[model samples]
Structure formats: C-alpha cells, structure tokens
Target: MRLPLISAFGLALFSLQQVAGITPPPGAESLTACSDVSVRKEIRSLSSDEWNTYKSAVEGAKGDRWIDWFGYLHERVSTKIHGNSEFFLYHRKFISDYEKILRGYEPNVVLPYWNNMIDYQNPAGSPILGEKYFGGNGVTDKCVSSGIANSWNFTYLGNECLQRNFGEADTIVTWYSPEFITSILQSSTTYADLRAGIENSLHGIVHLSIGGDMNTMHSPADPIFWLHHSNIDRLYAQWQAVEPDTRTYMYDGKDYAGNDVTLDDKLTYTSTPAYEVMRLGYGNMCYTYDTIQTANGDENALLSKRQRKCKPRPSKATQTIQKLPAKVLADFYPSFNKKKFSALENEMSDITPKQPMAADCSKPFTPPKPSEKMRGKMPYPGTLSKEYIKMMNLNSEEVRSAEKRAFAMIDELNAANYLSPYLFDLE
Candidate 1:
C-alpha cells in the first residue's frame, strides 16, 4: 500500500514541529501560518500611528521590568554567545522573545529595525537618532537627554539613566555602507563565513562607534540595541531566504570555547533549541522584513504603504553623499585611498551621482560641531578622525597578527569571567 503524499507546506510544518520541537499553541493551527503573519518594517518606515504604538510599548515595558529582563539576560549570556556560531541564532531568538514581550503590552506593536548602513556616512544626523526617536548621543554624565527614553531609569544599574556617547569625539564616524553590506551578503556562502563577516566587521564597528553602555555586555540597556539587532536579524533572514532549502537548517561553526555547534545546541537561559530559531517565519519566528518580502514577490505593496506614510525624508547630506561619484567622493573625502576606492567601486557597481553635483562641493567641506555642552563630553581628546579605511587596507600579515592579539584578549576575559574587578560600581 502506497502512503499519501503531502504538500511542501505540509512537509515543512511537520518538520518544524518534529525536528525543531515547535508545537503551535492550542487553536493556533486555525490561525495564520507563521510565514503569513505580521511584517516587521524598518524604523524609518513606521507610520505615525505605528511609531506611537511602538514607542508606547517600549515606555510601558520600562515600567513593567521588560527592559531589565533583557539587560539581565545580556549580562548573563554576553561572553558565551558573542564571537561564536551562536551569535546570530541566539540573538534572533532573543529579539523575537523581546518582540513577544512588547506585544504583551500592545498587540499591534512590532519591533522595527534600524538599517544603520543607510546612515553610515553621518550616523548622528539620521532622523532615527533624533530627539523624537532614540535621541542624540549622551549629554552630561553620558545620560541620554532626549528622545522617548530620556526619562527612563534602570533599576538593575542602581536606577541610573540610559546613556550613549555617539562617537569618540564630538563628531560621529562613518560605518559600513549598504554597498559593503551587499558584498558581505553575496560573498559569504556558509553560516560561519557570514557570521564572521558580520560579527567582526559590521557588528563590532557599530558597537565601537556608538560607545557608552552600547560598548558593554549589558548593551541591551539602551533601546537602540533592539533596533540594531533587529536589522542584524533581518540580514540573517535575508541570507537564509537566498537559499532557503539548504540554509534554513544549516548550523556549522564553533563556539567561543572551540566546540562544534549543532542544531540541538540550546540557547543560553532558554529551553529553546538553536535549530528552531534558525529559520524565520517558523516556530517562534512569525515575521519577515520588507526587503525579504519584496524579494519573495509581493511587489513590496506592504512596504510601499508604510513608505508613503512613515519614511523620513532623506537629509541633504545623505542625498549628496549617496549621489557623489567615486572619484569625486574620494576627492571630497580624503579617507579613500587607491585600494579602498577600488573596493568601494566593486561594491557599488551601479552608483551614479546626481547631475551637476551640489554647489557645496566647490569648497572644502566642514562637518558641523557639537553644542558647547556636548564639547566637554566628547569621549576622545583630539579632533574626530576617520580610521576605518586605513584599517581595512592592512596587509595580510598585519591582519593575522591582530587576530592573534584579539584571541589572546578573549582568552584573558574567558579565564577571569566575574573574577575580574568591577570596572564601575553597579550598585
């Protein structure tokens, strides 16, 4: 007797339940499949009502201990999960769980991601970092003095205010470009390869550039952390979607301690298996990004609606920098050398500067200075500098030597753990 055939969707649902150990809640089977559920939009794409709904949920979470829960989790699991194979999947689960918590406060609330690459040239100038959103960099005492989170105080850190020091000095530095991120997405073929490319380059740079609490293991204390990770998760989702058949269940690479990672590897502090969180739109994962949705062919109708209602108008600087020719950009910004220019050209093959380039190009450009109060709070002593291009152009020998030094530092941290003296008094 031949067995009955099952559709691909049926096969996927069965595998998701059996292999990934995902059991939909009672009556959830009558609900939409995870793939057909809600969509997560970019931060700039939230409508006024959508933005207000999200902000309300975040503010509500602060009073309800949701914020503290995330901070505590990060403090406990930071070292073990970072710089390892678990980095992507662990955070994917973490953020999804966080979104679920927010939804508890407001059913309509979906956490939006910040595509930091779009603001790479001028991070501080982005509207997402404005007083209306997460707010500008830290002011006196490194306390974030603006935005919806301005009044937030964390009980875990002795009720201190949330803090952020945007850049090393009064000026914010450049970040990895969309073009560069596109390269990373295209070049990497394996889970480990993509993980290293993202964690080492784009991910690490954002943390370093932001500084303050963001630079610490308890970085989740800052609201921006969630948005940042949401984008990271979106990238991981995009990568998986590119080759869904094989990539959905793919789990390889090693943990920080040099052990091979497996699908059954449990996330820190949770009963959830890593394999369950690896695939988006399955199990606990029920959302997709606009970019991914568009790639899968809905003509981005959902994104278009949000874009019409919520997208922030691009700033003149953002427009000018994005449009500038490679040669012209190299000339205007002294940071680019021959090798770096070539790399930029390769990554941005279709870039074309707007006609009759901005009149400002005729004169030497000067970045705006911070307010007088912020000048004293600048973290670095000297004038702000751009160092990433030079760093990226380092020789192979230099790169390997630096990796050795980084590994040694990690070893020291691992050996000490909580044994190390407290850098700051939490109490």
Candidate 2:
C-alpha cells in the first residue's frame, strides 16, 4: 500500500534514463499492476515461429560476437554476483540485458524460460535436449553438434565450441522437484535464505548436470543458459510477489565481501540499485512470468491475454508447487512459522493472503504419480568441485542443509505418491 522508499540517487538515475531517451521497458512501472507486463512463457509452449525466430536471433548474435561477450561478462563478474545476496538481483539484470540484445536481433523475440524441473524424471530424455531444442551431450570432442548451438564456434576462452558433457553417460542426475522448490518459497523468510536454497539446489545441480560451460562461470556462452536463468529469475520474482507488500524492496543477507547487503547497494557490473529490481513490472523490470501473472492474480474467466490454448497451465493437483503446506514448511524449518514470521510484523500490519503460484487448472485435478522408472531415483546432486565451492564462496553446511531439505521433501512426496506440478504435463 506504500510506495517503495527508493534512494535519492535511484530517483536521479531514473530521471536521467527518461531524459536520455532510453525507452522504458514494455510495461508501465507499477509493481502491483502486471496488466501490461511483457509475458515470458515456458520453453515448450513457444510456437514453431517463435522458436525459429529465437534461433535466428541467437545465431545472429553469435555471428556478431554478442554470445562471446556475454560469456566473458559472466566470467568477469562471477565472483561479484554469485554466492551472495547479489545472486538474484545480478542475474535478473544480466538476463534482462541479454534479452534486450536478443530483441536487437529479432525485435519480436521475448525470451522464454526452460522449467527444467519438469525434466528431472530423466533429464536427458526430455524433448528440450532433442534436435528441436538445445542439443544434449557433446561428442567425445565435447563439441555440441546438434540443436540450436550445433557447430557453434566461439572465441571466449580461446576458440571454444559450445560444450555439454551430461553428468552420467549422457544422463543428468535427478534435480529438485516442485515440492522442494515449494518449500523454499514458503519457508525462506529472508533474501539470503532464499538465495542459498536456490543457488545451492536446483540452480547449481542443473549446471553441474549439464556440465561444460554450464558448469563454468562462462555459462552464458550456451544458448540454454538464458532460458535457464530466466526460469530462475521467474522463481525469484514469484517469491517476491507472494507477499509484495512487505517482500518487495526486501533485501538482506551478506555480500561476497562478507558485508551486510542493503537495498541501496549497487548491483555488480551495473550502476542499478538493488531496490529497483526488487519487484517485477516496475522500474526497468518490464516483464512478468506467466506463472507470476497467475501468482500475481490473473483472472481466468476473463482470461489474461497472455494465456494460450497451446500452452499448458498448472494442474490443480500441483498447487503445492507454490508453497508446501504450512505444516510441512514448519516441520522443515521451525523458524519459518507462518504465524510467527511476517515481513510486516514490526509494522503491526496483518498478514494478507498470499498470491497463487500458478494458473488455475482447466483440467481435472488428479495427482498423477511418477512412473515406475522414476520412482526412488530422486537423488541429491553430487559434490561440487572444491574450486566451484570456493569460487562461489558457498557455505558447505548450508548447501548440505538444502540437500537435506530436498531429500526430506522428496521422501514426503513419494510417500504420499504425489506427482509434482512440474512433471504433471509429462505424465
């Protein structure tokens, strides 16, 4: 209900951008109003034309060396952005910048996200890795010669071909499920808690499983990298949207230098303040996820213009993707007590109903069970290389805690024979 307390400098910067003739993003600047926000859909939902246009734009960028530039920028700024509060903010801006570049190639290209969680059953088997999308495992030479980046050559790191060595003989290990991510969204009461849960869990596992550039700081070299991070940003934005009154503009936790971070802190590799990115559809954040739209209150009967007949919406059976039951969250993290914890508690305000995490399921609600082949195969990711651990300044114990949480959630879901929202469509 109150305006974001942006700093004087941020206001000045906003004024300068307006005067510089830099166009504002596609949407009007209002956190609670997503009506005009540019919508990003899941990868599979893209039409044949959209996919072709995206591929052409990427190929165009690759030819102009934009791909190499992004890869280099990521490596150059990795330390400043990863392993801390800046992780979400920096990546949000980083990906948005990439999107702008993408638009330069194909003004029609609005980046889509890859909800990889759905492919956890047998990640390597997903259609996303087929010739139609991002190709899977590089050959013995580690050169990807299929899908979008096929035969792509790059000068980053001295003439490299886009590479991916799937973790296990062309098959990646199982990733975190909707259930686990739900717990993180429901339980994390601070930016740092949310950051660790994500960066240490689904985010890292996907990279490590994919291997090659994905596992390296120069990951942006891979076209899939954009879709992957876009999904991550979507989750981050959804979490902020859940309780926007208090969560928007909420920034806390330690920085890479071990200093406490604040909303006013400058994002790494950019002059943008962290607060400006704390909410979607506001400031320079012109886009909103389709899921975030449902989460932010899209009306179905009226049907938000973004929803399409071809795209799959969430299955009602999996609303659990949005949040673990309060009881389950409290069981995992006692400190996350819904009753005791409130971002607005100090302000003496009442807690409001949280946003819906996904669109209403048009189909019947049925908790489809995981296939027999996938049963009991939900494994936590393998150990990180010491270099990766140290480079990200990752807290081993915290990462382990996240592992435990995932393990616990998987067990609970498996026991209930509950199917995850992510894998629902696959079934």
Candidate 3:
C-alpha cells in the first residue's frame, strides 16, 4: 500500500503548529531539551557565508587591542568548558536565539573556519599565522605554535593568557587574591569595581576566541563563540530581572581604552543594539540556572520565588541542596566560585556616578568621584609595556593598512562557500 503524501506548504504549517504548542515540562525548562522549538529551527536555517562574515567582523581587527583579546578568550574558554552538556545546553538555546536575529537581517552569516596551524607546525600553512601577522617583532615559529593553543585553553584561563600578554599579571593576581574575592563577595568593594574586573576578564575571553593578532579575521577556529557569547548576554539579561535597584547596580558607568561604556549603553551582536540582539535571538529566551539557596529561613520564600524564575530545581539524580548552592555560605566552600559565580551580579561602573540630567545645555557635566580604594596607588597589571607598544604601534598608517587587509581577507572568505555547515548544526 502506498502512503499519501502531504504538500510542502501543508507540512511546514503542521510543523509550525507543533512547535507553537511545545512547552517545557515542569522543572525541565533549564535543560537543553526545553529550549523553544522555533528558535532552534531558526538557527538551523542560517546560511554559511552569513555566519562567517559575522565571525570575521568580530575576529578582524579595527579598534582597541582588548577587542581582539575578548574574541580570542571566547574561543579558548568555550572550547575548554563546553564539554559539560549542563551548561552547554543553555548555550545551545542561546545560540539558537542569537543567530535568529542575525539571520533575520543578514541571512548569509555563517561560522568562521577554525585554524590550527601550530598543531601542524608550518609557518607557510596558516594564511594569517605568522610573526608579522600580529605586527610583533621576531616571534619564532615555535612560540607562535605553542602560544596559539596555550593561549586558547578557554574557560577562565583564556582570559589569563590575555592578562599575561597585556602585562596585567600583577593586577590579576592582586584581584585574584583571597582578600579581593572576599571584598567583592561581601559587597564592601562596591559593585562598580566588581563589574570593571569582570568585563576586563571576559574581554580577554573574546580576544582569545578571535585571535591575539589583528590580521586574522574569520579563520576556521571554533564556531561556538557566537552561542557562547549569547549565553553571556543571557546572563546579563537575567541580572536585569533581579530588581529595579539591582538593574541600576552599576549605574555609575566606566571608561576603558578610549571608550566609555555606560549602563544605559547597549551591547550588540553585530554593531546593533543589545535589545535588538535579544529580539533577534527570539522574542523570548528561556534559561534556567544551576540553582540558588538562601541563608536566612525568613528570606527563603522570597529567594525561592526568584530561584524558580531563573534556575532549575534539583533533579532526582542530585540532591536538592547540592543543586541549590547557598550564596551566603560561599566562604565555606571555595569550589562554588571557581565552577560558577557565587553571586552573579552585572558589571559595575568605574567612573563617578552621573546625576540626573537637566534640560539646560549650559549645565556642566560632573563626573562621579573615585572611591577611596580606587584613589590609592592602583596597580597596572595587564597594560602593554612601552617596548611592546612601540613594537606593535610602529607606524599608525601601517597598522591601519594591516587592519584593512584583514577585513578584505574576511570578505573573500564570505564570498566563498566556507561557513555554511556551522551556522545551524550545534556540533
């Protein structure tokens, strides 16, 4: 007996209906399986060229050195840490949503080609891999090969590589000090400084994901950086839901390199507003955390409500207490902070707080005063050395020309059919 066939239009309509009604089972929303069906479908449809172009834009050099650091860090940290499906599932969903945004406007966005030149150890192998690529003077072929892998270990260490390169080892070590973590955990340091440190650290991750060098644009490195960052963006969104006061936790604003990023300033996936990025991923992104527990029994009810909204409840496989790590009890266990954030707050401001704006243009702008701690002999950990700066910044015109060449190379990759497979498939 022959089976009746359904028309493509009818089949598509049927599939849409199935997705429209799909809902997460109680307490299962945190798992990857519970991700919105439509979002996943959208991600699956992206073209390869589109994905590579976006990757190139991020990986290619243009602005500050820290930007490259952030791109590189994303590559390393994601590769190192994405082994666990628990967190990776969340990342998958985030990728689905974020890619949807880009695909809507730029249907050709595809993942970059990941390059592992050092693994093969051929100076002529990688088009963009060479001592001169990064504008550094005389880095031996051996150092370039080892540096690529070691620098891209992913997770927190990825950022460390940038710190080491930027000469911020002393500053990072100081902040990584037990006392510093304690001060941050206790809220005594104020939220402003805390955010600055986290942003600095994460920017390193971004750099690692792309490349330490500005010449390399969208080479085939890892395709997962976009989804990984989408998860980071989701975390920022969750922090916004904390409360009105908490949303403004870092209202003070900050200055890095030559740019000042304020709380009101929007983050983007591709030079667009973050809110637009959020919408691009989907109208809504459902994410559940590991868990949260309250110290005070009185606060339990309030805490539970917030926890239910954000993270998943304990599974039958694990004890409830284990899943819900107590925030107040962080001092007792060091592992909690290392594995995941004990108290995940949004980035803080480093500059003085801005007062309410008046309608009069004649009114002078007054920046907030620095904290007493900030005023003290502040350490410069990861700043580029004078020698390093002189080496990379040889001629401003030359650097600009090199960056332009990098952009053109990425454009060629997009024109080629290289980035298609990675745009949709999770693996």
Best by lDDT: 2
Which residue runs of candidate 2 sit more than 4 Å off their true CA positions? 1-36, 297-316, 319-369, 372-383, 414-427
Residue 386 in candidate 1, Cα distance off native in Å: 18
Q: What TM-score would every model get versus the actual structure?
A: 0.68, 0.78, 0.28
Q: Write the per-residue lDDT of candidate 1 for residues 22-93, one digit (tens) a residue.
A: 343333343334534467766764556777888888888888878987988888887678767888988988
Candidate 2 accuracy as lDDT: 0.66
lDDT tens digits by residue: candidate 3, 238-259: 3432332333223333322224
Clashing pairs in 1: none
Candidate 2 positional error at 42, Å: 0.5
- Pick the TM-score winner: 2
Candidate 2 lDDT over residue span 1-427, tens digit each: 1101223453344333322433323232432322334668676655456677778888899999999999999999888888888999999999888888988988768788887765665688877787878888899688899988888888757787888988656777877655466567767788788899999998888887788888888899988899989988888876665555556666889998999998778898677877777666556676766564443234242233443431232344233322445555456533344443322111111111111122233642233443454443444545455676776668888777788778777676555455443342333
Where does candidate 2 clash, by residue pair?
none
Report the alpha-carbon TM-score of model 3 versus the true structure: 0.28
lDDT, ranked from best to worst: 2, 1, 3
Cα RMSD of all models vs. native, in order, equals 13.7, 8.8, 22.1
